[model samples]
Target chain A: MDAKVSTKPHEMLAATLSQEMAAVNALIRTRMASEHAPRIPEVTAHLVEAGGKRLRPMLTLAAARLCGYQGEDHVKLAATVEFIHTATLLHDDVVDESGQRRGRPTANLLWDNKSSVLVGDYLFARSFQLMVETGSLRVLDILANAAATIAEGEVLQMTAASDLRTDESVYLQVVRGKTAALFSAATEVGGVIAGVPEAQVRALFEYGDALGIAFQIADDLLDYQGDAKATGKNVGDDFRERKLTLPVIKAVAQATDEERAFWVRTIEKGKQAEGDLEQALALMEKYGTLAATRADAHAWAEKARTALELLPNHEIRTMLSDLADYVVARLS
Target chain B: MDAKVSTKPHEMLAATLSQEMAAVNALIRTRMASEHAPRIPEVTAHLVEAGGKRLRPMLTLAAARLCGYQGEDHVKLAATVEFIHTATLLHDDVVDESGQRRGRPTANLLWDNKSSVLVGDYLFARSFQLMVETGSLRVLDILANAAATIAEGEVLQMTAASDLRTDESVYLQVVRGKTAALFSAATEVGGVIAGVPEAQVRALFEYGDALGIAFQIADDLLDYQGDAKATGKNVGDDFRERKLTLPVIKAVAQATDEERAFWVRTIEKGKQAEGDLEQALALMEKYGTLAATRADAHAWAEKARTALELLPNHEIRTMLSDLADYVVARLS
Candidate 1:
């Protein structure tokens, strides 16, 4: 840890890669423009400018910098990662029928679903173009596959999200496809562009993959108990939406006949009523599912930390490891 | 035109590259599947198995073969083109709120908009992965830009479709963006994979571009006057949809004040009433707008045919040139 700074791990990583992050931000602005379609830039600017941590792009930049890279392709790769992340966020809002994101009205709600869908497609194309400029077919292969995996994960979630029969394994698969795939690709491409050693590149990929899984697990858990002011997400939103995240899945697996009927009435039939959210939390606590889910998140975070040992020792690597801890730490 | 056979140009092109077309179809079938997300293939199969002619992939194969490409990469490139085309069609159905496609229910209608959007995205990602496997960065650059242009065109059409002030130039830009971009990419990548000279590649691109424009124009005109049984489209469908196609643009240019009010009510304000279609047709007849629109289609078809003369002498070349003529000849 940096004793002189009170910054969190993600904020510390962003500060360390501030110059590269600035380049990525600028490139995102430059590339999202359309000569004929002004709505594209308008819609994109609303979401892209609605500030988040830019964690995915920072991972790319940090991996490259930690590998002692001196070339400029890392900037392009960082922007590519951000574009892919942003594109998914756009489409996810449309698929989830979400109204709010990052404490603001989502692009879909403000503009329209058509704008969100088309602009998301535009960003995907822009990301591919950016990656192709890197001239590494290997990098293209990784990102392209990541994109497919991300979409596949989303499709799986569509079928698997609300169904009471969806198991923990399916939930894990969905998370890996939608969340970790991009994280690994983002970090792997960074190392590949820097011409890092195979071992280090694989390490970066592992670090990102585990960190993303832990991060998602924590996020899902937080949705039930998190301070809405801190997370900017309304607790019980997923329950209201009938999403079968890990905690609910764990609780459902242990449910009695009566409790199962409650799940069916609420999640499957969408017959939610007042006090249902409280009852759902009571069931989760009855089965100790929240504690179990938190344990899984910690395990994934520890795996992420352990993966960093394969990389060459660096300050960025330390930050990445702590970032993993910070992911699960929020829930605790 | 070939003197011996009684087949149309597209059929001739397909027959010549039958094996390659089969391979492309098989590759599409294989690649569209997701082990975890069976919904991806299920949705894609609804469109892929809809029995529409594999025109775009055939163009890729024909161009590659005409340029004497004796490699397997063309098959991959052809599948890439088809996937991209299919992906766009899925998204287009959602954006246009279209129910029917090729006389069958669209993927969006058969499933849901979420399936259409996410599966279209999956196919797009799969297309990029296919193109990347070709190991040609130039091809990636071309296809990626084309994808962006296609999305931009769709966005433009969303705004331009209802506005009476949208001119022919804007309509042409939309046509180029939505349809011609993919056609040009399909043919350009074909010749590019063959390692053809820059001039021949340019010729292939021009041929695809002009042919796509002609094909779209003919289809639009067909919606006004052609046999709905043959075209699988209702007469005046675009009019009812408030689309500002070429014929409407032409008539609107020559509209009298009363006629302008009619268009403003029907198209701009979307206060369409009965007898609007008959009056619109009579207005077009008064202004010779359909004839003018037909002339534009024929001009583009001729431009396409002329561009093919720059390619080497081959049977496939004859079929492609004839394909240009056939694109407009259907309207007659």
Candidate 2:
């Protein structure tokens, strides 16, 4: 097939589901407005309309459409997913004291941290309201569990981010909490709302879980080896922040005594000298951790593609399969 | 009837519902624990096990028992109400930059703002899960709406707390959002779980709403006039903080042109001299706003008592009625 060079897979998914995405957008706008608190819509609009890919909501829409859903509730669920995502971003900025997000001033910077925290809360309540409107106890259960996992994952990451004792298992748990939990919940609810069979729902969940892990792994890898222009982040940003992502976790697992001392000084103690970033990169390369990390991303992407085979083949399905590949395609 | 000076009305309610309150406490402790994130419990325990009045959850338990609820779900709902209350308190401390709560170091102060924010979110999500377990859509709706109201009220208060245009209605709206929404939801969900008559359910909501308003007004009133030793706060903390509570709102409304300038300088611009608190108090006295505000508290408390007339007369109901009067009993 001849490729359209300008368009991405998510863009194709958006084109195919433009009508439903529009409904989701409209619902998001309407729901984000506060009758009393005008500050709500301002902060929410800044994040929601910041040209985010809307990838999570599209997963919901795509999975539902793939399962032959014709109902309007999928739109509500999509909006719910996006609201949850936006709420977290607002709080994440506050937690991280981030000044920029998606190449714009974060809500915490534009407004006060108080506004960011409370408005993030308002979005969370709004998301809960949206999910409750679905009238599906099963959907509520999934989303609520996802919410807990996401929160727990965040707390774990906060405590574990710089700890050298954080192994691969702990890293994966944090990854799932911060990223994959929502992705899987987003897709799982799509199949759930469509009343798909148990096996199909499980498959949908596997697809999203694998896809999100791959997405996050690729993101972390890109922090070290990615083009700054394409990734919109400088090389070694995560290393500078002292975050122990997959590549570092992999390298740390095989560090020598001297190397361990270096990890402790830089990551645990947060004492960095000049050339630390280069040294960290060299260590990862010495252990082939970055390449191994890239292989892990591709492996997860493969799992995501394989999971899609359980569902009916359609235009959306094909795009979703390609989207998985696209998430890891930048790794090289 | 002879008065028991040893116990407060809430204490009496606690004595009457001891078994159920134990269950609620247990559920809270059990649910607040995170298998992965130790920080979750550390932050939550700092606030939850802090000697808070637990008055909101007691409202849930009292209302449930007052309506003769037999099931165990009320405990879960009561825990859910407390979780929501605790979650808000955690966020509130962050929003307020509070150093202390319940006369102890606040969770935000004890931990970083990140832990407070994320743990508060964990509790909120846990509350959502507990409510979902109830399987009552109506119950979930009340709590969701309450959560939204609570957040909106905080946002509204953030913007309107110092604005001179804030009037009695806006004060009431802010009060309802921050205080009464949970109180009413606490009670409403109780009656809901009991399958009580709609009239009784409405009465439960009305009782809680009025009681919460009266409770907040009395607290605010006490801030200006109560014993600092008993209230654990210095007089004029609100005025010092430039908060536009009921007393300040009333005084601002009746202020003359020169007095309006005083308010704009003091509350709006947050400029205060040594005598500003004295001057503010004098303005309230000049307009009889303190007396008038006391009257409003009494009126709301009376409304709370009147609402209870529709509920069945039981030990819990009587205690609840007295609880309404007890809220305003602090006023001179």
Candidate 3:
């Protein structure tokens, strides 16, 4: 939980992506600022300045550079990816009624739901404009597909929440739609716009897919066991919201009748009280669901590493592999 | 308010667009029906099946065909536009906290804010995917810009809702962003994708723009003067919301000290009760604001007709001209 270890992975990625990240930041700032509507800049700057990890756009820039893209369009595309990611986060916070995000008040909390919804929409439009500026219909196709997948994932999560019957397959699909779809699209489109061979493009997509999946699973696992200070989120926050994440889904699958009764009461019926968090954690521990989820994350990280083999061995590719490992390394 | 007059203008455009509209409907039904998320279909079907005029997407299809397009991509694009419109309406109702839309319970009323937000997002993603299928970056540009404009309009409306200082220029900007932008883009892209000449493309955009402006002004005028049963919306709804629509904005500008105080108490201070609606209408009539709004709509309709002069004479063009007249004729 020390700052030293916590900052290492992001710092390493920052070192690798310094120039591209700067460009992406500049583009985001420029595009998000609207002169006609002062409200836009106000709402967007709050979240944009809050300082996210910028992982999705980094994947885009890294993938494009690794694929030998020599053009400037990658910068625009990277910004587009970031805008889409930010827009989704804004709307997600509103949907979840989340107050805090990344150690700051969410846009919805800071402003209002109206601003969050409209500004999120503005970012979506700006992202589309950025993609069109690339003049690559294929890029639009990939990113638009990613957008749909992300929305579908969100809807799936909404419907699956508090539903005990949701299993690993459904959980995986939701995770892929919500998290990995954008990651895969970001990397895949980089290779795509560079006109990389189909096989290698597919490989880049697979790499991103595995990495994103691992990243989300790791975060879900951390909800049970992570130090709250390191994650900047409350432990069992998902549990409080009755979210049937991977760990809970797995745990529910193995629950006894008594345990099932507890879940139905706490999650479905929303009867949580003072001891519910501890009780949920105890149940997860008893079932070894946290460990199982961590195992899944490690397996995905390995699969991501394997996917990189299809790419030419380069510094970026190696770093991407390390990043994949780093994503799940916290559980250790 | 009679069916004879109400349906005349839309009838021709509707018939011309019937086949494409059916395809758009099918696309919406299929995409919105998710296997993993039953709520997606449930909420979406509520709005999609609601009896909207489908005017926006019809403009898209008509623009394409009038330009002599032989390809089927326009159908997908039309569906994309409709989906975006529907998605916005779903979210808008939530933000506005409205109880009804199209004479039925709003999606948020039937489901909840969470479902409305998530499903609206699903439709947005579906829209992007549909547009990408058209394989035209130009089309993406037009629609993306429209999306941003729409969001900005919504945000502008949100902040400017109770502020009496919001003037004619600001009101027009809001209308342009909220309504005309999409209308123009819907029609503009139709011609662009069909490879129409630049002059004609501009003409189509102008035609749609003027028509949208006319349509919005007519709607605003009707809110003060039209029959509630015929419009399927409450009379003086804008007045109740303190929204700075054209009539209100203009009336505010020309108000005496006494009238201004009335507005300040009722609108800015939210002190109005049920009886205030009649008094507000009386003030609007005394100052001729209602007539002024109708004149604006008539002027825009004329401009819309004028824009069509750029296009070669054809049956579709004639129908479009009549449609412009029909949009404003409702105010009478």
Candidate 4:
């Protein structure tokens, strides 16, 4: 435990906050069961026990503790966060027709699309029940908005996919809706439920927002430069899927006539062929878009770090700041 | 309006509650939209404006008025109920792989599964936001449980399919989880938000539970017997799908060896052949289960009617009682 505490931001926070996370895990286990539908627990257990880092919920616990909350609601709120995230992941896998997640077969692959969609919904409803238990209207408002925004972002991506003109503005909007909204809500609710000052709550929200954007940008960048072993994803999977991530979007914006024709044939039309991925990589290098996307991620990480200064000085504060650095550190 | 009020229970309720229903309609129209994801509204409008009777929302509005609610929160609650109902229909169409609804193509058939699932999710999140706006924790608890129950019911149905061992108890449990739970929630929240007495709230819950069960049983029976034009569904669609609804469950229990072979060949093995739907229908008649199922629906309808006697009487009370009768009246 001592060796791990100094190794990673989230792991250190988890080690420091083990007891509360245990309570959150227990709450998640208890609430996920149904008297009539035993299938729910089976599907949920497949995903929840898939050995995720539980980073978002830990953020909630860490934020609440750092803000001096000596109460119990944070556990419920953290569980809510995890449930919402897990629900979206389930639905997302179905939507993406994904076969694997985190080096294992996705829930949709194991069961079916019907199970994934309905079980995702069950978890979402379960999440609302959890947040309501927190008894904070402000917390409800944050999470509710986050949920809507997450759906909206996903829908936006659906409409925007395979289109050449989806710009950076739209890309950021999608990121905010799909990824950052929950992050901000998870952190904001921690401060809000703790009855922290409004400025601190706002600071927490900003910190989460920037951190999530950085995390997503870093992820998109890693899809291009990341190791299949380290990231547990085949490199160029997004390219193969024709997804319009940041690196590709940047490369598209800078494409010459020949390059634009290549993208249109390969991406817009999805007529990808042998050596096309290599050609796409060559064009990206020509545009230096990988470096540019990496820079953008670094800047967002810096923004996240800056926002942490507004938070009250505490041990968790250092962890959160380090967490921001760790998000971009993945790119390095 | 006067002409309409005397024609049917739903028409009567609509005529009596037109003004308030208008507000609920307006709220639904405004809230189902998204500035970011216009597809949200497009998909919702396809389902919401398809001209089905807004029965669940009417239950909320009717229960509120019967309980002497003169405030506006009922509109939010009613809208919440409709959003939840609509959200479920969208997801249900996808799960059932249904092509049509209320004589119109389903949103899943018209758009795509991703839009249906994500838009359904957006509507659910919007429902939670609407319910939260009512400022009633009791209402939240009731509806959240209903949402969870709905998903659980659907998942239960998925697991219970193609299995001959699924009995009447499981059928009723599925009915309660999927249909009656929402109906009960719609009425219970109406009373709870009005600050009505606990007994009245319990009565409303009982009324909705019975009504929804009756309504579902009636629907299953209709699928076998009703005119295709009147029901907007081809007769025996459930049989074709090999779904083990209540009507078939009852018949299967009393099946002779020869009848069991037919069921195994058609339903369990799904090796459906010519005259199989007709054969299934003939077997149902031979066992007298259709009439027996109809009798069960009437009993539930009568139970719904009986539950209303505990409520303080109002004009809408009569409409609700008649609505219970009308739910099963279609079977005749």
Identify the leading candidate in terms of lDDT.
2
**Residues B1-332 of candidate 2: C-alpha lDDT, one tens digit per residue:** 44664467888887778788888999999999987789999989888888678899899988888888889999999899988888888889899999888879998888899998999899999999999999999998888899999989999999999899988888999999889999999999989999999999999999999999999999999889889988888999999988999988988877789999999999999989989899999999899888998999999999999999999988788888888888888896
Docking quality class, candidate 2: high
True contacts kept of each: 0.84, 0.83, 0.80, 0.77
Model 3 lDDT on a 0 to 1 scale: 0.87
Clashing pairs in 4: none
lDDT of 4 by residue, B148-237 (tens): 888888898888867778899989888987789999999998889788889989999999999999999999899999999888789998
Q: What TM-score does each of the candidates earn?
A: 0.95, 0.98, 0.94, 0.95
Q: After superposition, how far is residue B150 of candidate 1 from its true place, in Å?
A: 0.6
Q: Across residues A75-149, which tens digit of lDDT does each residue of candidate 3 receive?
A: 999999888888999999988888988778898988899888888888988998899888988888888888878
Q: After superposition, how far is residue A204 of candidate 1 from its true place, in Å?
A: 0.6
What are the runs in model 2 whose C-alpha is more than 4 Å off?
A: A1-7, B1-6
| Over 4 Å off, model 4 | A1-6, A254-259, A273-275, B1-6, B255-262, B273-283
Better of 2 and 4 by DockQ: 2
Q: Lowest lDDT 10-mer window, candidate 3 chain A? A: A1-10
Backbone clashes counted, model 1: 0
**Steric collisions counted per model:** 0, 0, 0, 0
Candidate 4 lDDT tens digits, A70-145: 8999999999999999999999998888998877899899988999999999999899888888777778888888
DockQ of 3: 0.77
The list of candidate 1 runs beyond 4 A from truth reads A1-6, A255-265, A271-279, B1-6, B256-258
